[model samples]
Structure formats: C-alpha cells, structure tokens
Target: MAEPGDTSVLATAKAKSQKSHELASCVIKEPLFSYAHLQVLNGNPLQEPIELDALQVRSYCTAALQQFLGIAGTAISIDILKVDGSDCWLRVPRDSLGAFSAAITAWRGTNENGVHTTFRVKGCSDWLGSLVGQVGQDTLWSK
Candidate 1:
C-alpha cells in the first residue's frame, strides 16, 4: 500500500549504484597509448653519443613499438655504447623506419639498408613503458 507519490526505495538505490559505477569507471585510467604520438623522425644523430646498455633500451623500444604500433621483429642490430648509461645506440632495418619513429616519438639509430636515422624518444607515457637503469660502459663488450 504505497502512496501514489512515494518513490520506490529499491529503484532509487539502484540508480545511485549505477551512477557510482560510472564514476568509478572514469577514475580508472586506460593505459595511455595512442598512434597520434608516434612518427618516423628524420635527421642526423644528435650530438650526444649513444651509451651502454643499448640492447636493453632497444628491448624497451621494441616492446613499446609492438604494444603501441603493432610492430615486432623489426629491430636489427642493437649496440651497447658502454661509454655512458643513457647513450646506447640501435640499428634496425630501414623498412622498420616507419615502425619505430614517431613525430611525437623520438627514434634514433641506423637502418639495415645503411640509411641511418637517429632521434630521441620522449619518455614513453604508458602503463608498461619504463626506463630501466642504463647498462654502464664498464660492462659492455663489443663484438
């Protein structure tokens, strides 16, 4: 025997629950990855030299490329400079050119076709992207 104007307590609660869920969804950030931030950078290698642990950095680079751009196995040679931690250098196939470089991205190094392109990647802004400590030169052994 509810009054005509009376609101159903259960209905009001369900509506509030749905609203709370929507608010929660907004708070959950999806991994920040967008093709809009990627591009093939064209230029000379920067004045800064590539450093040690190039292999490791390249690994991160590869994963990021695959995760963000859907490219894999495109990398060719990765050299660890060993002079400085952050100065690692990489060389991949020229075909990979379009795959690695992003205008919003910074790609550096040579390609397999002997066409070299060096650019720096701005820090990756994704849940999986991370900067591991550089591989120091003291530990590098060139082939």
Candidate 2:
C-alpha cells in the first residue's frame, strides 16, 4: 500500500531535480594530463640516501618499464617535471597513466652499491596546481 503523502513528496522532488538539470548549459570535458610525484626508497631505509639527477631518474624509469613491460614500455613518453634529492615529479600521457604506474610499482630499483631501491608514488593528479598545493601543505605542516 502506497501512502498518498509519500507519493506526492517523491513527485515534487523529481520535478525539481529535472528542472535544475534542464537549466544547465552543455559543456564538453577534455582529457586532463596525468602526473605522478614519486619518492626513491632504498632496500634499507636506514642506509645512506640515494642521490638522483634528471638523467638518472629518466634511465631508472626506462629500465623499470623495460623490466616490467618489455618492448611495449619503451613507447611511453615521460617528462621529468622536477628532481630534488630522492624525490622527483613526472608527467605522462593521460591514457598511459595506468601502464606507467603499474610498471614502476612492479619493478625493483637498484643502486650503485648493489642495494635495491624502488620509486614510490606519493601523489598523482591531472591538475599541476593541485599537486603543487600539496607540496605547500607538506612544508607548512612539517614545521
């Protein structure tokens, strides 16, 4: 059995929602650029920090992709946004984000001392501004 009051309330709510949607303009959404912020971690966290430059980071990423994804991995284009100590920021095509992240996560990184290391994804986003905001927050709250 349906209550008369309940049916009227439901009808009113639906009418309002439909009217709201009808008033909105049509807008097309385009794909956004994907970015990943990563931290380099050594096999032994307590050991000396691993220093990496832009070139080293690029090679490391390529090697990781090659190790995990093989020949197909080489096709991925990566742009190194910034590199500071063991932390680095990178950009990849939006469509290739999944493969890039997967390859990096699956591969184990090694250092000059024969110690193993890996890149850890700290944050990923399509908007660079939001990513930079996070960095600011970290600095503000850390002190």
Candidate 3:
C-alpha cells in the first residue's frame, strides 16, 4: 500500500497534470466557409497557358452563378484567394457549396478572342489546407 505522502504517487499525479496541460484541441463542426480548388481550362491544350487575374476570376464565377441560378446566384458571395497560371482558389459560404459547384460545372464556357475558357472544380473541402497540394497526389507517400 502507498502512503499519502508517497513520492511516486505525487510524481504520477504531477505527470498526469502536465500531460493534460500540454494537450489542447478545438473542434469546429461547421465552418463558416468552404474552400475550392479550381482549374481554368481552354478548349485547346496546346494554346498558350491562361494566367487569370482577380478581376477575371470574379467575372467568370459571377457569370457562371448568374447563368445557373439567375439573380439569386449572382448574390452568392465568392472570395478569390489566389490565382496562379490556370489554377484558382475560392471560398464560399458553407451552405452554398452545392449551388456554386453546380453553377460552374453546368455553365457553357465563354469565348473571347477565339479562346474558350471554363472553370473546373478539382477539389473542395471545408478546410482549405486539404486542397493545397497537387489535387490527386497522396501527400503521405510523396517525397
């Protein structure tokens, strides 16, 4: 039997207290916005690569929404996070992801200067970090 003043008992209690203090966690069941990784594609792969600016991205998304859902779709908020080459990142209300995805997928692409352009959703997640890398690469197995 261990005595009330036993050093081992006190040490064990201290260790448990320290362990609890060392660990912290926060769980968000529902995020306010979801992120999407979009790739802009043209009809011809051999054509010059498309470099999209913020304005162009907004215009494309807005046009898609407008065409799909009319005035209501146009009101859906879209935030463009980054645009590199033909890839773009966007954030939209968590509840509106389905509508947004449908809009982009179904809309016929626009033709400008004989170049046809459209958006494709590569991946989407409530957490942005999950969509950061190459869309299909398994990060765990990659060097």
For each candidate in turn, give its C-alpha RMSD to the true structure in angstroms: 13.5, 8.1, 4.2
Sorted on lDDT, highest at the top, how do the candidates line up? Answer: 3, 2, 1
Residues 1-143, model 2: lDDT tens digits: 55777887798778877844545676536455688988889888678888889998898899988998899998899999999998899999988888899998888777666787889877888777777667756678678
Question: What TM-score goes with each of the models?
Answer: 0.30, 0.71, 0.81
Taken over the whole model, the C-alpha lDDT of each candidate is 0.41, 0.84, 0.90
- lDDT of model 2 at residue 138? 60
Per model, state how many residue pairs clash. Answer: 16, 1, 0
> Model 3 — which ten-residue stretch has the worst lDDT?
133-142
lDDT: the better of candidates 2 and 3: 3
TM-score ranking, high to low? 3, 2, 1
Candidate 3 residue-wise lDDT, 86-106, digit = tens? 889999999999999999999
Best by the TM-score measure: 3
Off-target runs (Cα >4 Å) in candidate 2 are 1-28, 136-143
Instruction: Identify the superior model by lDDT, candidate 1 or candidate 3.
Output: 3
| Residue range 1-143, candidate 1, lDDT tens digits | 66667679767867877743433434535432321111123344453433435454555566556554554433333333222444433333334434554521533344535544444543232322233223233357653
